[model samples]
Each structure stands twice: as C-alpha cells, then as structure tokens.
Target: MVRTRLINHPLVVGLLEIAAGEIGYEHRGMIRVLCDVEQFRQTIDLVVEGD
Candidate 1:
C-alpha cells in the first residue's frame, strides 16, 4: 500500500515517529494511521512532493 512505500523513506519514517505509538499494522500488510488525519496527509504530501 501507499504507507508501505512511504515507510521506506527516512523522512516519512521520522515524521511517523511522532505518532509511532498510535500507528500499527492491520491484516494483510495494511497500516492503521491513528494519528491526526491532517498531519498524516501532510506527511504523505511532503514525501510525495519530495519525490
């Protein structure tokens, strides 16, 4: 999934660490992003923009 790809990036990993306690994996390699939706979106946006 998108998160799996994002997780490969150091920048995204650092940003995700802010909410690491809340983030987890679900069944079949799916990730559960339980942090602020806006913040998560921004993280993805930052990584995508960087690419």
Candidate 2:
C-alpha cells in the first residue's frame, strides 16, 4: 500500500515559505502539497538543483 509522508525538512520548509511570501499571503501556518513518491523525489531534485 502506498502511504503519504509529511515533509518538514528545513530546505523544503524554507522553500515553501519563500513561495508563500512571493505570492503575498500571511502563510497562516497551514500548507499541503500532495504528490506521489516519484513526483516528490523529482521536486526535491529540482529544489536541490536550484532549478
């Protein structure tokens, strides 16, 4: 069975904060990004690559 994981790594959290800031919102302290394992891995790769 596929399971979901919560990603709270500092890099990922910082990225999310930056994104929320760029869009101009209070960031209310709640965020949800859903993706399968492969997509999640790809996202992390992109972030690591700074792309």
Q: Choose the strongest candidate by lDDT.
A: 1
Model 2 per-residue lDDT tens digits across residues 1-51: 212232465546665576666654654655544445676576677555663
Collision count for each candidate, in order: 0, 0
Off by over 4 Å in 1: 1-3, 15-29
Go through the candidates in order and give each one's C-alpha lDDT.
0.66, 0.54
Residue-level lDDT of model 1, residues 1-51, one tens digit each, is 364666878867665565465553333453455567787788788889988
TM-score of each: 0.55, 0.37
